[model samples]
Structure formats: C-alpha cells, structure tokens
Target: MKQDNITAKREQEKRIVSLMIRTYCKGRHGTRQGLCPECQALQEYALLRADRCPFMEAKTFCSNCRVHCYKPAMRENIRAVMRYSGPRMMFSHPVLVIQHGIESIREKKRLEKENHEA
Candidate 1:
C-alpha cells in the first residue's frame, strides 16, 4: 500500500513537470533574458543535439540554472513514483485536476502578458 502510494504521487508530479516543459517550449519570449531572439534560434538549433549532448543550447539555462529551472531529475524522481493512469485520471482525481489546471491557467495569462509586451 505504501509503495503504491509513492508511485501514485510520483506519477502526478510527472504530469506537472510535463506541463512545465510544454509551457517553456510554448511560451518563451523573444526579448526575454537567456531567451532573446538569438537565444530562441539557438534553442531551435539545439534539438538536434539532444541525443548525445549534455545540454541543448536552446534549453541550457532553463535546464542548468536553478532559476525556476525544471531539472530532468524531477521527472525521473516523480515518474518513478507515479506510474500514471493516463488522462482519465484528470477526471478521477479532481483535486489534481483542479490544482494543475489552475496553475496552467494562471501561467497562460502570465505568458500572454509577456508575449504581448515582448
């Protein structure tokens, strides 16, 4: 029972981390520091290096710097625990749905503001 609980918790964290990565790729601004126009271009170029590379230049800062950085370790840690049941859980687990959904909503607004002013 205890082991199962741990897996469930990790799986949930996996979803949240997935959301964060999606947000980064979908949201970064042109003039934003560590992510200006040239930086963004670099990120586009770095995807090809993901296989044998330590860091993709495009996502290097976000992956390395601890500044709101979403480390891969978090995914490894939580995913090992959660064993996700898929999107259906969003309905089955109302609390997780509400929390992650709200966070995504607020972040969407924030990113919208950034995109506009950029």
Candidate 2:
C-alpha cells in the first residue's frame, strides 16, 4: 500500500468513527466531547485497529471487510453506535456518508470479483 493510501484510509476511519462517537455520545450520553469514557476508549481502539489493517491501501469500510477485527464486546458496542448513528449521519455528516457509501460499493464489487476468480 502506498503511503498516501494508508494516510487516506486512516483519515477516513478517523472521520467515520468520530462521527459515530459524536452522534451516539451526544444523543445518548449527553456529552459535548462527542464521547463518553467507554465510547472514547472504543474509538481509540477502533482507530488503532484500522491503522493496522492488513489490507492497507486496499481497505474499505470495516463493516465490509471479510475479517472481523474488533473484539466481541467492542464490536457490539460499535455496532450499536453505528445502527443509531448511520441514518443520522446523512443529516450530520453528509459528505462522509456519501463517501463511505461509494467506497462500500466499490469494496463489495472487489470482494465479489475476488470470489469469482477464486
């Protein structure tokens, strides 16, 4: 993976996780920091996992990946945050929502191609 691609992926993951934290923490935890203590820890863990992703430049949305990297409890917590925040993202972070949607589609296609070739 190129350095630029790695950087871009890290930025994208940071943005997405940040949005999720903002939405979830603000709505549920009633915090302006965009994260409660637990969510803050989870966000840091998630970013770390994304930064070390094996696919590197080829990485897509974590949800679309064949590998499940997050720990079970953290995964469920993040899933809850995403489920609550995903729809809200369109209104709060429209550009990121759109970018992620496009990337997810591309990832799906790539995965399908890999499967077919195999």
Candidate 3:
C-alpha cells in the first residue's frame, strides 16, 4: 500500500484500540468514560506497537500476526479489552467496525493462502 494508506490505517488502528480501551476501562475499572492507570498504560503500549508494527498497513489483525510483539501480560490485557469491546464496536462505531471486520477476514484468508503455499 501507499504511504498515505499506511498512515491512515495506523491512525484507524490507534483510534479503534483507544476506543476499546476507554470503553473497557470505563465500565470495568470504574473510571466512568476515562481510562484508569492500568488501562492508560495498556492503551499507550498498544498505540506504540501499532505505530511500530513492521507490516503497518499490510498487516493482518494483530491477533493474527505471526510474530507476537506484545509482552504476555499486556497481550492478555489487550485481548480482554478486545473481547469486551469488539461486539460493542458494531453498535458504537458501525462504519469502523465493518471496515475492520472486512479487512480482518481478508487478512485471514491471505495468511491461510500463504501458509498453504509455504
């Protein structure tokens, strides 16, 4: 993809992850729409990973990446946030959710094809 596309995708990923963390922290951590300290750290770490991702716009969903970049604890925290917020995304941010869903499916298929080829 073009550089512009990569930048756009990175920004989108940042936004999506930020929203998920914020929502999760607000409800479960009792922050009431704001992230608590732990969630704040997780969000920052997630954004850093997304920004530094080698595949950038070419990446599959982070869940499907071959190389796991996040540390175990942070990864689990993110997974929890995702599990809580993913379904809710459809209702809260339908456009972004749909786009990401489609992209995730496509990326999964692509990875499967590569695995088969290998």
Candidate 4:
C-alpha cells in the first residue's frame, strides 16, 4: 500500500513537471505542438532525476529536499521553466497548482515541526 502511494506520487510529479516543460517550450520556443528538443531533453532529465531520487519517499517536492541532486546548469534551467510556467499554470492547470501549493505548505510545516523537535 505504501509502495503504491509512493509510485502514484512519483507519477503525479512527473506528469506535473512534463506539463510545465511543455508550457515553457510552447511559450518560449513558439512550438505549437510537442516540446522543442531542448525542452524535451530537460523534461527527460527531470523525470530521470525524480525516478532516481533517494528522498522521494520522504519529500513532497524537489524544492523541499535537503540534498540537491540536479546539476547546477540543469537546476538553473528548471528554475527558469518553473518561473515562467508556474504562474501560467493557474490558467492551464489550476488544480495541479493548488495541489502543489498545499503539498508544499504541508512539507514546510512538517520540516519546521521536525526542526523544532530536534
């Protein structure tokens, strides 16, 4: 049961990231259809990172993770994509945006409580 939940969470995360990348590519690269090559590559890299993330079971999002596994360049690229697409997501994917926000808040509270206890 726990494993199923983890797997579902991972898939959900991948789906959200893919949507963000596609949104970024379409907005920035003027791609009417599928992602541009660069965006596709970044999407793949992000999925790979998520799949192999050691903290997947413990963390709500990569941003909340204490350890940064993405390379510096890739991290910056993702940051740019998020910055561009995050606000737009409210229009294109409001449900996902709300869910992500709730999860992030929960994670923040969890971490703060953990720190206080420690």
Least accurate stretch of 10 residues (summed lDDT) in model 1? 54-63
TM-score winner, 1 or 3: 3
Q: Using lDDT as the measure, which candidate wins?
A: 4
Residue-level error in angstroms, candidate 1, position 110: 0.6
* lDDT of candidate 2 over 1-118, digit per residue (tens): 7788788878877877877877898998899765788888988988888777876576666777779889999999899999999999999779878887897888788888989999
Q: Model 4, poorest ten-residue lDDT window?
A: 53-62
**Winner by TM-score between candidate 4 and candidate 1:** 4
Cα lDDT listed for each candidate: 0.42, 0.82, 0.88, 0.91
Q: What residue pairs clash in candidate 4, if any at all?
A: none
Residue-wise C-alpha lDDT for candidate 1, range 11-106, written one tens digit per residue: 444444444333343343323234444334434333322333322222222223224322365434323323343244465566766775676676
Regions more than 4 Å wrong, model 1 = 1-86
Point out where model 4 deviates above 4 Å. Answer: none
For residue 108, model 2's alpha carbon misses the true position, in angstroms, by 1.8
What are the clashing pairs of model 1? 7-81, 7-82, 10-82, 11-82, 43-58
lDDT for 11 in candidate 4 is: 91
